[model samples]
Structures are given as structure tokens and as C-alpha cells.
Target chain A: MLGLNNRDTRFFLIVIALTLFTPFLLQPFPEGSAMAQFNAGYPDLMQRFAIYGIFAIGFNILLGLTGYLSFGHAAFLGVGSYSAVWMFKLLSLNVIPGIILAVIVSGIFALIIGYISLRRSGIYFSILTLAFAQMSFNLAYSVLTPITNGETGLQIRLNDPRILDGEGASQYTNLFGLDMSSSFKLAMGDYVFTFNAGYYFCAIIAIAAFYLSLRIFRSPFGLMLRAVKSNQHRMNYTGLNTRPYTLAAFVISGMYAGLAGGLLAAMDPLAGAERMQWTASGEVVLMTILGGTGTLMGPILGAGFIKYFENIFSKINDNILHAWFSALPDGLEGFLVTIIHPFVGKGWHLTLGLVFMLVVIFLPGGLVEGGQRIKTMFSRKKNSDAASDVKPAE
Target chain B: MDAILLQTLNGLDKGAAYALIALGLTLIFGTLGVVNFAHGALFMIGSFCAVTLQRLLSISYTTIDPEKTDFLGNPAKIETPYIEGWFGPEIGAAIIDWSVPLAIIFAIPIMVTLGFIMERGLIKHFYNRPHADQILVTFGLAIVLQEIIKYYFGANPIPTPAPTAFKGSLDIGVMIGFDPNAIIYPIWRLIYFVFSLIVIGGIFAFLRFTTFGMVVRAGMADRETVGLLGINIDKRFTIMFGIAAAVAGLAGVMYTPINSPNYEFGMEFLVLSFVVVVVGGMGSLPGAVMAGFLLGILGSFASMNEVKQIFPGIDQIIIYLVAIIILLVRPRGLMGRKGVMEE
Candidate 1:
């Protein structure tokens, strides 16, 4: 089906289905309910889910398959955002040109950085990429102010030289006549679902990117990357140009980050220097690792989990906690709240840090490994149960 | 000449900070083969030691003062420190004034203990893991430590003042036959430079002269070989980790007055320090110090008005620019021994 093998075809179908139904799936609670705050179906966040999903998929191609952990991916992301914003400033509010420019610019940047950084491998490689990213960040926040708009970041002004913003056309991003922010509000009983033009747009692109990544993962080039990771010495002895392969992966991933950045700007017309910061890069890495580095579904899962936590979960406050445990005895609830206070709400960072540590230490392969472990355990239990039942009275 | 000298002096203080942090980083890396992303947090904690002592000493009781009023039109509730109440105002005030210096004595043990706990509790398990995994775990630890500090002390930069005695700048240029104030440098900065020198010299001497240091050096060179000789290299490495932590702590303690100790200061310094480490070479101790000073000096020079005229914000990226150039030209770094981490 669709030129993919049976398994891949199934995977594609699953992803398509998920992306199509995301609005309904994400909006679990009814509007006006207390749990409405937890709904991630809003345009802004849903757009992020798709955008970051694309980003992670690209990242996995390099880090997961090639085993070249680029710590400066956020640099590419920032570059993409800057380029997209510039495109908006000069050309039009149309996202196509902006996104294309983002990919091309970031791809060039990745090519240059990757060529230099890939000279060394392991920790040295990580450091080199980090240095490059830091330099870029410093430049964006300070030196490149004319272009990047300094620490305040670049934002669209009312009088931008957008050549395509004809006489009475809208200043906002659009696809032909369809507004990016335009959404359909479906009212069914108590639940209200938002079908946003922007979210769907991003979702389609993310799915396409995901499909491309899947193809790349299954391609012969991917096998060579795995080979490079598993045994570089033998690969060298056998005489293969590992550099080009790694560099290609790096550029591809950088372009993915760029696309993600462009989509972000498409959703909200702004670009900040902080987007280039190492922390942003680290977040992407964490997303990839947390989801399951090498797997297709893992990166998307990880990105969603993190974005959800950062956006929705972090907003849970003392009031929410109190409400949650209100059914318990007053004294017990108060004690529980106090005990749990330090790891939630504003203390979400502590939880994030601790969770990161736990994931890295315990589940090195990430959440997917945990899932696999559970599945195997259940299967083993069932098998044992079958054996026992088949046996006589024992 | 004086302007150059002033810049050099400016560089020295920053150089001292970079050197101290990088030195500890090298020590830990050399001894344990683990890249500690949380080392800067140790330095931050060291600075916080000064803050902690300041808070501890300034534990106060409110008393109504009829002589003065606060912001509102009421009798000022003057708070007298416990130290002032216990020991007369003069000595207590002196103690409070010298809190940063006093923090050195307070921070060392705490830092060492923290180091020990960090190693035994967390990093010890990661010895055999891939470098990426190690970096991730340490990065996580850094975040946890940062958030914890932020939780206790808000995100603002807390200015931990130096002693009043060392507040003024020394007219070293006039003493060297230049105009007065032409080459004036902060006294505390000079002290910090001298302190760094002493610390660096002391560490070198300890490694050269002492038996434990010798054994540790031997272990760093070849741990299995030292273990084969039944030296218990693990214990020595743990002690080395403690020493490294104390070194970073001392640096942080001294740096509080220079740069107000903020929760994010660790992260801010970490990138530069890590760059210093890389530019110095992965496991080479002297290289770290050399790179730190070299980068620091270059950075100061780049920040000059003349340089900024040529290329704005050059100073901000000078260290990174130098690092990239160096990494490209010499992958092993200035004094990095070949094949340590060349692959």
C-alpha cells in the first residue's frame, strides 16, 4: 500500500489516523469543565506538537541512526526562525516561501557546522557543536542585532515591507484565502472541538516529514549509518566515507529543525535569540531520547509528552492539587499537598530534571523500552499461565 | 600602555575564574573519565555558601528605634544581627563584612561532602555508560541543582559584597610611573588572581610532592595498573573528586563579589568553562589553565571600544570564535597530549 512495505504501510496509516483525529483526541474534556485547562487541543499547542514532532523525527535520523549527537540543533532551529521571519518581513505572510527559506538557510548552516564538528567524534563532537551553537546564540543576542533584533528578538511591525501584502489584504499568514488561525468550532453536547487551519497545516507537513524519515530509516544509507555507529574502525578498514553520510544526516536533521522553526513563526510571527540557546537544543535531544531514540513513533511521543508537560502540566497549581486530593481527609490532603508541592507547578523543573535523570539512567532506550518491557512481562505471564492450565492438577 | 594594562588586569580576574573551574573539570575528567556537566553548579553552590553564611550571621531581631523611621511614617523597626547582639557591634560588623572570605572556610567541607555525595549517589553508576548518557545525567543533575537553588533563593542576582577594605582600586599604574587612576585595578580582583595562583601552585605542588597525589596521578595514567598494585584507586579518585569540588567551590566563593551570585550563573559560566576545557584539551590540566587565561585575555581585548568599532559584539563571541578556530586547527588543543580523546 502506498509504495511502502506492509509494516511501514500500517505505521503510515496509524500516524495519519492519529494526526487526523488529534483535535478530538487532545480535547478529552468538555468546554467550561475544570479539566478544560488540561486540553492540549488549542491551536498554539497543537501546532507545537506537530512542529516538534517534525523536529524530533529529523533529529532521530542523525542521533539515533548515525549516532552523531549534535548538541547545537537549536542553532539550526533559530536560524530557520530568523530566515522565516525575514521572509515574512520582506516577501509575504505566505508560509511556503518562509518555510523554504528557513530550510535552505539552516541546511547551509548545518552543512558548515557539521563539516567542522564531524572532524571529531564522541564527546569532542558534542563539545564542538555546543561551542558553535553558543557562538551563534551570542551573535544573535548581541552582534547580529541588525538582522536578529538583539535580545528583544525580531517581531513583525505594522509597516513591514511585505511586497505580497497587497492594498487591503490581511497582514497575517495565510494559504491563498484560508487564514492560518482560522478554525471551525464544533459543538457536540458539552464538548467543543477546535479544527484549526494552522494545526492541520502543520500536522500534514509533520506527517510528510515523518514519512520521509521512515523512508530514510529503512533505506540502505541508514544501514551504513548504523554500521558507522556499531563499528567505526571496521567501517574505516573497509574504506567508506563516513564523513559525508554523517554530514548528510546532520544537514537533514538541521533542515527538519529549520522547518519546525518556520512553522512556529507561521503560527506566531516572532523569532527570539533564546530559541538558539543550548537549552532549546537540549530539549529536542531529551524529546528524542525520552520517546525512544531509534524508533519511528518514539520521537513524536517524546515531543508530545514534553510539550504537554511544559505547557499544561506545569500550570497545575496548589489549587489544582487541593482540588485533586479534596476527596481525601482534610489533614491527609493537606499533608499530601505539602509533600507534593516541591515537585509540581513552579517546581515542575525539579520533576523534569528528576524524570530526565530517571529516564537516562533506568530506561536508556527511553519510554519505548519501558513499554516493551511491560509488554514482554505480560506475554511471559500469559505463556506461563497457559502452560500451567495445560498441565494436570498442578 | 595603561589602558592595555587595565584590560589585562580585567582579563586576569575572569581568567582566574575560568582557570579554577576548568582545572577542577580537568581533574575530574582525568581521574574518572566522566564529563561533569554539573561542575558549574558546584561553583554556584560555593558562592551560595557565602550567601548562606551572610544569612546565618544576619539572623536578627526587630527592635523599635525612636531615632529613625523606615519608608513608612512609623518608628523604624531596626533589626540588630545576632552576632552584633552576642559580640559587640564592632566585631560582629567586621564578621559580617568579611563573610565572603569567611565563606571559604565554610564552603570547603560542604563542597567536598556534596562532591562525595554526587559521585557515590549518582555519577558512580554512570562510569561504564556511554559519554552521551553521562552528559545527559549530569545535565539533568545541573538542572535539578539549579531549580533547587532557584526554589530556595529567587532568580535574581544576589550581590554578595566584598570587605570594605578591598572595595577600592589600587593605582598600580602610578606606582609603575604612569598617571594616577590610569591603570587602577580593583584590589579584590588582584587578590582573586593571587588566590587562584596560590590554589593552582598548591594543586601542582600537591600532585608533585605528595604520596596521595602521586598515587592519584598514577591512577589517572593507568587505573588498572595502580589497582593491580593494590592501591584502591577508587578511594583516591573519590578524594580527588572532593578536592576538585573544593577547588571549584573556592573559585565560586571568591567570585561572588566580582559577579553577583545568581542561580543562572552556573549555566552562564558552564558553556564558557566547557569551551575552556575543550580548548585546553580533554584530560590535560595545564592546557585548561592556559586556554582559560588565553581565552579570557582575548575576550577582554575583543571588548575594547576600538575592537567593537571594527566588529560589534566581538567580545561576546571572541572566546567561542577562538575555540572554534583552535578546534579546527588543533583538534587535541594547545597542550593536549595526542590520542587521549583524539578519536
Candidate 2:
């Protein structure tokens, strides 16, 4: 319970330990083991987990703190991704410049949307954001085809001239002297530990973003934002213009989304307009809610949980299920697997829907509240036992 | 001028769909104050109603015929349904030909029951929750419903054909004393337009004339006060929800011939319908209907090849562009009543 105050530091330690040692833990299993196949310890998926974590964290700031539920935040992420990819195409492959450009472009886009949408509050605001996001998605798919590459998506071409490196060109760019596509591997006995350079890069950025969020959470500005959420009328009556605070929060979250989007493109230099679709926006909302909306750690945990499930569950073919079930009785194992089959594999979404329903119904405050409850129960049990001993002494 | 008329006709056909779905959305929002995200899924299930009825009608017994060699070189003896036994061959053939239109009668009650179960089982529990939670739960329900439809229907689009009689297009240009092939319009699309008008009119007539309609409208205005009078406003609201579901179902049934019934059809138009509802103002029936037509027309105009040359991507964004402008100018919408979504 006391560690809750320094939960961020504790979480940081946990992340570092896991990232450093996961390879050792992952290596003992055979190369073709199911655990190996499902290993998120692989850099590509881990990078995605961190990037999406940042995106969800940004969404939580708006939905959790301000109580302004946005069904359209994916537009910013899409904009960021597109811009990042374009940067790679037109300029040097250095993700630093690409990421900066993405943030700026996405920020400006958010400014216009926030300015207009902030005029409405509550559900109207939600609808307004959704409408705008939908429009952006449509435009990207069609009219912006030349720019966004529509459904086919935009990708890097090796034929392009590289002014930064000159003459002979490369399809991909390096990240501040390190190759974006490179991996770092360590070996111990029969075990192999492969660490993705990009994963570490994203991990660093996520840590910095997390700290920034913590600062925002503790500041007076954050306090005002929460006050506005609780009672906007009271804040208005007190002579505070709640619009600016909300707008600021909207912009900040929008930039965070841009950062995440840039990281995605940096890792893989392809951007599709579908990334900006309303469904993508809704995903972050689900992630934020599934974790613990207002809690800082919830979004990251939620992002990891969702991405892990999406990757792991989607890969569970009939063969994989049968492998696990073979130890049981012939008829019984087949029956059990058949019942669970539709809820995984291509049907992984069914399981996701069930989890979301349970979370909404039972754990309204999400996993953070569940954690608190467990902590409270243990403390109460110890206190009761101490009281019993005191009564005997008396 | 000819192009304009043709586009308007095209717009009206599309508008008919927007209006029907929006009308249902408005009715539910008016009475229950619950934004059911699963409404689109209901519309989808309604379209599948035709597919189901068609399957039911296709229960023909096959017999091997040595004399007849079909594509597979098998015997071709097909037995028709009981309807064929009752009606003569010509009339029965025609009736079977128009089964999609006939499915409308079957869809209404089925869709209504589906709506009722959904409201009572899932939506009722979410009545006191925040709009976001209601949205999340219903969205989940929508995904589940769509997946179920996908499982049954598979991923491909299944073409539900119009009857042979209405298969061709009409040359309205010649009727208007212009060139013959200038303004060609499909006969079935015209039927869809007329059918939507009748359905819309019937709903308006019922709401305006019937005692039950009056009670529902009263409930929408103030449920607490209506309940205080011992009228059981919640029950009426539930009925209103059923009617809304039926309205969407009818739209889907008629819509089958226009485009094939596909599992994703519901989501395809869901956003556009929501835009229509917002631009028309939430919970306002006339507003929904009006905005639906207006946006549909405007959207069609924006999507015209000529229009695209000028603005590039106006078609993709036309509905949203209209929505944004409306929200900015009249925060309550063009016809939205005050205090509907303010709380």
C-alpha cells in the first residue's frame, strides 16, 4: 500500500527488469515451443505495445481527467503516422526529424479541431469529435489518396534520392546513428536473448512520457482540469475559462498521439489511412477503460494486455489448442477445445468483447480499483488477527 | 440540368435509407434517452432477415432425373414450397420472384422482438450509467452481433436480387423531352424511394393520430411526469424502441435489392446516419428526417465526378463537413431542442 505513492518508480523497475531478463526466461523453451511463438519479447510486437501504450495514456488524460470522452483520437495518430512516413520519403531517414515534423503537424491539426469542438460540451462534444474524425478518415481514404496513399498505404521507395547520405541510396533511415532495422542479441548456453534496439528506444520515450504525465497529474493545471470535469459550472462561476484548460488537455493528448504515431512509422515506414479510421480511435478508448482510466499505470498495463492478447489469441490455431488438450481424455478434451475455439484464433475479438463487458460491469474503476481492493483485504485480515491477540492479553 | 435531376434522384434513393435509420435512432433517443450503438447491428440483422426468409423458401427437395443433365450432370427435379401448392404456377413464380419484398412482413415482428430482448437484457442495466459506458457496452454488443452475422453469412457479399419485373432502368430524360439515355434511373430505386415515403408517412400518421403514439410522445417529453399519472412510461418507451427497430428493419428489407445483403452493411451507414441525427438535432424526428435527406443530397453532390475535380475529396467528407458547420453555427443543431444533450 505504501508503495502506491511511488508506483511509477516501482513500475519503472518492473519494466526494466522484465525487458533485461525476458530473453533469459524466454530461451529455456525449445525454439519451436508455443511460448516462443507467442513471445511478445520479440521487438516488433513489443515496440507496438509501447507505442500504443503512449497513445492510450494520452487518451486517458482527456477521458479520465476531463471526462470528455473522445471517440476520435485516432485521427491525430493517423496524421502523425502519415506525416512521419512522408518525412521519411521526402527527407533523410532520420526518425528524429520525422518525429518532430509529425508532432508539429498533428498539433496544428488538433488546434483547429479542439478550437471548434470545445464550443460544445458533454455528448455533443463527443459527437463533434467523432464527426470530425470520421470526415478526416473519409478524406484520407479518397481525396487524400495522392498524399496518404489511401487503402494501399504509403511506403518508402528505395528509388528515392538520399540527399543526406548522398549517391547510393538506402530504403530505410538510421535512428540517430543506430539502424532502425537492427537488433541486439545476447547468448547464454543453449539460450538466446534477442533485444530490439527499437524497443529500447520506445521504452525510453515511454518512460519520459510517463514522467511528464505524472507531472501534469500533480500540477495545479491538472487539478483545474479535474475540477472542470467534476463541476464545470462551479469552475465557470469562479471566473475560470474551462475551455482553455480543456483545449490544452486536448492539444497535449493530441501531441502524445502524434509522438506514438511517429514512433510507429519510424519502426516500420508504412502508413495507411485506415490507421486514422474511427475504429482506431475507439481502440485507445477501450484500452484506457480496460486498464484504469484515471490511474497513470493503467493505460500501459491495458495496452500491454490488449496487444498481447490480440497477438497471442489470434495465433491460437486448432493445432495449438489440440496440443494443449492432448493430455486430457479424448472425448472431453475435444469437447472443451471446440467450445473455446470460436473465442480465440480468428475469433479472438469475441474474447475481447467478453472481457470488456466484464470490466465495465464489475470493475467500473478498472484494474487499479481491483488492485486496491486486494491490498485492503490483506491489511484488514492482519489487523483483525492483531486485535484478537490484544483481546486475549486484556 | 439533366445531370442535376439524375443526381437528385440518386440522392433521394440514398436519402431514403438515411431517413429511415435516422428516424429509428431519433425515436429511440426521444423516448429512452439511451444512445444504442447496437442500432446498426439491428439494421444489419434486419437485412439478414431477407437472407433468412430466402433460405426458408429454398427448402426444395431434389430428385435425380436420368433424362435431365444440369451443369454437374445430375438429375434436376426441384420441389417448390407450400406457397406454390396454394397459388397457381404463374402467380407463385412471381411471388417467389419477389420474396425479398415479401420478407418485409416477416422482418418487422422479428426485428421488434430482437430489439425488445436487447433492451431488456443488456440496455436496461445501463440506463443509469454514463453515456460513455452505455456507448462502450452497446459497441461491444454491436461487434458481437456483427461477428455472429459474419459467422452465419461468411465474409462475402451475397446478392439478393430484385424481382424480374423491376430489373431494368427507366429513361426519364426522354419522358422530360430530353435525350433518351441522358437521365437513366433504376426502377427498383424508385420503388425504394416510394416505399420509404409510405413508411415515413405511416410512422408520422401513427404518432400523430393514435392514442399510443400520443402517450409515447408524452413519455418522451417527460417520462417522470407521465409515470406519475400511472401510465407506466417505461413500458411505452420499450414499445417505442420496438417500433424504432421495426422501422430500421423495414429499411433494411427494402434496401436488399439496391445493394446485396452483407454483414458489414450496418457499419457502412452507421456513421452517416449518426451524422444525419446530429445535424438534424438529436431526438427530433423531423430533424432526423430532414437532415438525412439534406445530407444525403449534399453528399451525393459532393461525390459527383465533376465536384471531385474541384475540391478533390469533398465526397468523403461532405457529411462530416456539414455536421461540423452545423455544430459550430448552431451548437444545438439545426432543429435540436434545448437541453436534450446539454445535461
On DockQ, the candidate that comes out on top is 1
Off by over 4 Å in 1: A384-394, B65-76
Error of 1 at A170 (Å): 1.7
Candidate 1 structure quality by residue, lDDT tens digits, A1-394: 8568987898799899999999999999999898898999888899999999999999999899978788899999999999999999998888899999999999999999999999989887888899899989999888789999998888888789999878777778887757899999999999988999999999999989998988888789888888988888899898877889989999999999999999998888899999999999999998999888888888999999999998987898999999989999999999999998888788888888899899999998888878877766676776966443331110
Clashing pairs in 1: none
Candidate no. 1 TM-score? 0.97
lDDT of 2 by residue, B10-41 (tens): 89988999999999999988888888777887
Docking class for model 1 is medium
TM-score of chain B of each: 0.96, 0.95
Q: How far is A290's C-alpha from truth in model 2 (Å)?
A: 1.1
Could you give candidate 1's per-residue lDDT for residues B4-89 as a string of tens digits? Answer: 88788889989989999999999999999999999999999999999999899999998999999888889999889999999999
Deviation from native of the Cα of residue A130 in model 1, angstroms: 1.3
Write one digit per residue (lDDT tens) for candidate 2, span A1-394.
2223565567656755754564454355555665666665677777888899889888888888898988889999999999988888777788888899988999999889999888888777888899888888888887788888888999888865545755544456577667777888776554566777787788788877876787788688989989988999999998878998999999999999999999999999989888888878878988888888888778877888889899878999888889899999999999989988888887877788778877887787777767766765776777966433331100
